[model samples]
Target: MKAMLPESVRATGADILLGNTYHLMLRPTAERIARLGGLHGFMNWDRPILTDSGGFQVMSLADLRKLTEEGVSFKSHIDGSKHMLSPERSMEIQRLLGSDIVMCFDECPALPAERAQIAESMRLSMRWAQRSRDAFGDRPGHALFGIQQGGLEQDLRAESAEALRGIGFDGYAIGGLAVGEGQEAMFGCLDYAPDQLPSDKPRYLMGVGKPDDIVGAVKRGVDMMDCVLPSRSGRTGQAWTRRGPVAIKNARHADDPRPLDETCTCPACTGYSRAYLHHVFRAGEMISGMLLTWHNLHYFQELMSGMRAAIASGTFEAWEAEFHAQRALGDIERV
Candidate 1:
């Protein structure tokens, strides 16, 4: 996490960072972080930090995780220790971390679930959302976001949204779409998901996606998104550009003299050539990941900024058209 940010700081010039409640809780424990002067001091990030409730990770990564009416029980992925994560426990963990934005604990089941299973999951999450809200009590300057999970079914999503609206939250997140579902299906879901929730609240999309995916989601009314793809792909030699993604290790770029993307203002684009980037990545140089990660994150932030500006100016349609056109053509050689 520390390594991912310094490059991001240089590229996108982001002021704040996100922390994972589940990851931190597994290692240092939120209590320890609070005793050490809260997450801000513990992580050395003075700016606002948003912590996820760990629901996704608990279901996705942990083995032997059992779900019941009370909560989820599982063995720690880091260690073999047993633990239970309930709504109350999740709220206490976030509170201890002193996060500026906290997410409500909700179940996120894998896609293609039976209608009965999806309905049950949605109802359980709603019940847990109430518990999370109740446990959090009241805290000023701190925000709680509720996750709406109903798979790709429109009716289920609406039901989840209605339940969340009744419970009340600072923000609403559209969950359970980006998990192996194609862009078209995801977009179809997003078409109604944002409108189903309150317009005044910020809408977040979880575990989303490629550069094009981000642009499309934003155009469809998503305000925020999170993904490990950019950073993870950077470490593996993938560079995401406005044109498209370029696998840096491809032999075609072995002697290319131009930067990754001429439109990119990232240090890697302005300061380094594709040939050099390819060489570093092929040679297993540590700086390769740092540089490419910086570029990818910069690209993502630029997309976000462009969308925000377009929305404010009411030119999102035109901007989205250009966004789609740019990616339609593969990255051309920069002379």
Candidate 2:
């Protein structure tokens, strides 16, 4: 986060930043952060910060995690310490972090589970979601969001959404779909997920996605999303561009005297050329990752801006078509 955002905040201007609850709880401990004066003061980011419940990591990253009706017990991925995470504990951590938006702790089961398994997980998460709300109490500016987890099945998703609404939350998130399901399947699930929730409240999609994925999600009525793809891809020398994903370290870019994207105004696009970026990437220079991360984040912000505008104008369909068409034209020299 420090590597990616400080420069971009001044260069491109970002409004809000997202934080990972799983990583923070493991390292700094939310109480320690609160002692230091909340996440905003600790990180020096004054804008809004959204923190997820550690529920997802408990299921995904732990080696020997056990789930039950009460909560989850798992060995820490970092130090092998046994820990139990309940909805109440998750709420306490987010409160300690002083996040603007907090997510309800929900069990995100792996996709392709049996119907019975999915139903069981959804029921447990709904129960936990209620516990999270009860634990959160209330704050004037702070908002709690509930996560809907039912895999890709429409009926289950609807049931989960209905349960979350009944419990009441400031927002709702479509969870459990991005965990290995392809875009087609994920989109199919999304077709019904957002509709299940109230239209007035914000709709969030957790741990989602590539450039095209974001566009498709917004078009399907999702209002916000968070993903680590930009920063993760940047470390590996991949650049997401208007024309599609670009491999910055590829040999073909060794002598190409062009920016990553002609229309982009990121430092990588405005100040540096492909040849220089390629050299930096191959040499493992620190600046390569910083610049590429900034470019990818800037592109995401741009995509959001376009979608917001299109939605306001009621031309989202046309914009989505053009987005796909542009990505279809692969590697081409802009002469």
Candidate 3:
């Protein structure tokens, strides 16, 4: 996977990639990765890499995570080993990984919780953000981003944004959304969230969504976003395009000889047919994942590029109109 990523990203024109702190720590540990020359060398990808603080995984992936004033204590899902992740420790881990962009350690409360509960969690995350800033100290050319958490409350989001601004950071991330909040509610929060952060710094929407979600967020002034949908869906026989998602594993594609997307230049779409892709996926061939993943990433990057160009040319509204128009046409009829 690592060997193919660099080439795939290059083809997609992606400038950065995100690495999961929790998963990497569970496998190789931060110290071990540092001894082996950090994640850049380990992954063999020299491009900029952003590492999350593992706080989210501590809440979601760990077996019995206990949150406290300092941090969270939990057991590894992989080996059942106990571990603790504090703001300082999270900073240290990202540093050891030699990440270009490091995220602040912030607690994320699941949605549908009481507003009071979310407020308390947001306050705790703010305190941890200060600690993370102190521990990160000075790292030339490296960035530390503060995550704004407030569940769905606008006032609390403003408060969190103010706290992050007071602590100062190279960038700001809108966290705690997309945890189950549907796109409508997420967009409602985003309508005001991005404006709360400093206009000079980049605003990132964390764990954001599908093609439409990205377009909506970008329209709201979010400068960055990260999601596993493209790659994950690709591995599951899904393909995203201008017209919508294509379920390549369906029987309708069994005898289809067309490419996944005629407009896509990726290998899966340009060098192979839908029938061939369907056969490989049904056979559980590893190449199916590789090809589909490549295509998905390529399409996402193309979408991003189109958005960027549209924004620069001051034609984003028209571009978005056309985007929706195309999707309204739906996927091509099954051959």
Quote the positional error of residue 290 for candidate 2 in Å: 0.5
The runs of at least 3 residues in candidate 2 whose Cα sits more than 4 Å from the true structure, single-residue gaps closed, are 5-7, 333-335
Candidate 1 residue-wise lDDT, 82-163, digit = tens = 8899999999999999999999999998877788998999999999999999998889999999999999999999999999
Q: What is the lDDT of residue 282 in candidate 3?
A: 94
Cα TM-score of candidate 3: 0.98
lDDT of 3 by residue, 256-288 (tens): 889988888988898999999999999999888
lDDT of 1 at 165: 97
Error of 3 at 91 (Å): 0.4
Worst 10 residues of 2 by lDDT: 2-11
* Residue 146 displacement in candidate 3 (angstroms): 0.5
Best by TM-score: 3
Clashing pairs in 3: none
Q: In candidate 3, which residue ranges exceed 4 Å CA deviation? A: 1-3
For each candidate, what TM-score against the reference? 0.95, 0.97, 0.98
Q: In angstroms, how far off is 319's CA in candidate 3? A: 0.4
